[model samples]
Target: MGAPARKQRSGSRMGARLTVWASDHGRAAVGALGRLARSRVASIMTAGVLGIALALPAAFLLLLDNLERHAGDWDDGAQVSLFLQADVSPEDQAALAASLAERTSIRRTEVVSPDEALEEFQAVAGMDDALAFLDENPLPPLVIVYPVTGTPADEIEALTAEMGEHEAVDTARLDLEWVQRLQAIMELSRRAAWLVVILLAAAVIMVVGNTIRLAIENRREEIVVTKLIGGTNAFIRRPFLYEGAWYGIIGGVLATVLVEGGRLLLSGPLERLASLYQTGPLLTGLGLQGTLALWAAGIALGLCGSWLAVGRHLADIEPR
Candidate 1:
């Protein structure tokens, strides 16, 4: 009976301790918010700075996403053209096209006979009169192949090499050099984004740290009094941590608003431009995941900034 009574009392004590802890945190949160309310201009100014820092990187990242999507929409890396031997007749070319249609690697094939190729060159190159003197056609039969989507570059190159070895194929060419260049550009853009993020993150920490240091200075006398009255550092530190967290959360929200507003403002012009480029519309604003990540990043920066400030400055303030 005594053992069960002791167990019950232990459980009750645990529950009461948890309740007290929660109450303290709740009070701290309210106190922190109230402090911000008291100095609205300063809080807004700090948060605005953080928001702008976040928005710059976010905008560039969204632009890169749109460019990537536009490139992908054109199936830029999904085609290879085969120019057949001059001796391969139109009938043979037609038969080769039929055979290519059944191959898994080749999604679609179009056969351009020598005559049609010559006619196109005559029309586009303005060389019809010069070509009229020739007795035989100089252009060869061509087969334009559209590869299945998402086919690896290596596989496509291998297929091109194999097709070039065919007796009927004079040459197989895949104009993927441009695609490679685009991919390189995308890689560079990604690196730039990371660089921007790193610089902005440091800026955020510094901004929050400076703001927190000022707050600590403003309450120096109160801190000294608390120390004299035996208030533990943890107890004294709670409100400041909560205050920093509030700043971070608000800053993140402001950043989201700024980013989305910019996206909306640019949507009309970008959508029209995308139509001209014959790609899907430009990438949209930050989705749920991105918004949440922004908020999380902001909170982390605020906490770290506050922690650094408090650790350095709190040690210097004493009853004396």
Candidate 2:
């Protein structure tokens, strides 16, 4: 009976200690939030700065994503044209076109006979009078081949080279200079987005760090007193960490709002512009995954900033 009673007492003491710890941390977190509320204007202003800094890069990256999505519509998917050897029989041209059409990479193929080619040139160039002087039809049979979905410009060039090696193919041309240029521009945009994000992420860290430093200064006396009364550094650090977390989370929310808000504002005008060209695909806003990532980045940066600030300045106010 005595041993059981002793065990019960030990359990009660441990439970009591756990409760005390829970309340201490809870109170610290709440107190830190209350402090931010007290200085609402300054806190809001600092968060706004961080939000704008984070939003710029995020918006640019979003724009790049949208552009990449619409790259195919921007005339980058040019077709390949194959001309058969002049002496190649009509049966050979048809066979070649039929075989090329069977391949998955070739979206479709159209054969333009010599007579049709001559008629098109005559219509476009108004060269019927000039062509009357020729002894025979000089145009070779033509095979126009389009690329399948997701086929890139380089792959089309490679396909063209492979086609030219065929016995019946006189020449295979894939004039995708414009597509190549667009790909280059897209690559540059990707690099630029990363560069801007890196620069802006550093700015976010600085903004949060400075804000936390000011908060620490305001609580210098309280922190010193807590230390004098034998409060551990970890106990004192909890509020500041929570405070930084609040700032980061709130800033991230503000940044996401700014990005989506701008996207919303532009959607109408953008839709009208796309509609003018008869393209049905509309501008898109951030999806669920992207929105969550934005919030996560904001919170993480906030915690890091707070941790850095507390580590640097909290130790300096050593009850002196």
Candidate 3:
């Protein structure tokens, strides 16, 4: 045959072989799915375990995300209290508050006169009678400054320091201890979430691997016969790999359902609570991208687990 004809024939053979390979893979995948459906209860039980394992971490991370968002709201609520000099006049105090309020960093400011400050203290401390004994009020006028929401903590601190330096001011204090504590808590929660993710991911792999190993043993005789009849190792391994992939896909779907279901269950209570506080939604679930990523993770873990099981156990099944 001429060179061109021979090349064409070779190409046709390659294409034909590829088509057959693809067809076999399609059949193996469908067969694996059908086998699982035949044993519905056991398949569901295995998938359920994997679903729960995956869901736990996803739920925790979602909670953490909500918390961080709420904490940011708290950051906006933080206030700075400025104590005026004892001798500073009420007019000067009001003027200082007004000046502070005009600054871009300051959201607004309230001037509290000595009498108002003392009255508030007496009400809170229940020391009205004790304070009556003093000839003159000892409390200083106050300027309560609310920083613009979402202002950086460092900028807030600098603003506080600037307020304290004002001629009419005695001291400026920003109660940020609570904010610091919240930051520490968020950091700890993030680390804990990561740890849970790692542990649960491993558990999922082990679960799938053990299940695949059991399947390999149950089909040992069939595998031996196939090998004796000239089946390649890849051919024997294909169905099990598809089986593992199906398990992963199912588990991933189940996990998504569990997480979303929990979110739905909590949504009403959370919405009511947020309404009471006059805030928006307090919790959010994994959106489209996140759901896809979770499904991909499930498929990857399933494939890894099945590959490990097949690689180890398939080698031991011989035609002896």
Going through the candidates in the order shown, the clash numbers are: 0, 0, 0
lDDT by candidate, in order shown: 0.87, 0.86, 0.90
What TM-score does each of the candidates earn? 0.93, 0.87, 0.85
Q: Is candidate 1 or candidate 3 better by TM-score?
A: 1
Ranking by lDDT: 3, 1, 2
lDDT of 3 by residue, 72-189 (tens): 8898668999988899888888788887788988889988888998888999999878999999998888889999987877888988898789888888999777887888989999
* Model 1 ranges with Cα > 4 A deviation: 2-4, 275-279
Error of 1 at 214 (Å): 0.9
Reference-based lDDT, residue 166, model 2: 92
Decoy 1 TM-score against native: 0.93
Query: Which residue segments of model 2 deviate by more than 4 Å?
Result: 1-22, 72-76, 122-136, 152-154
**Candidate scoring better on TM-score of 2 and 3:** 2
Clashing pairs in 3: none
Global Cα lDDT for candidate 3? 0.90
Mark the regions of model 3 whose C-alpha exceeds 4 Å error after superposition: 1-18, 102-104, 152-155
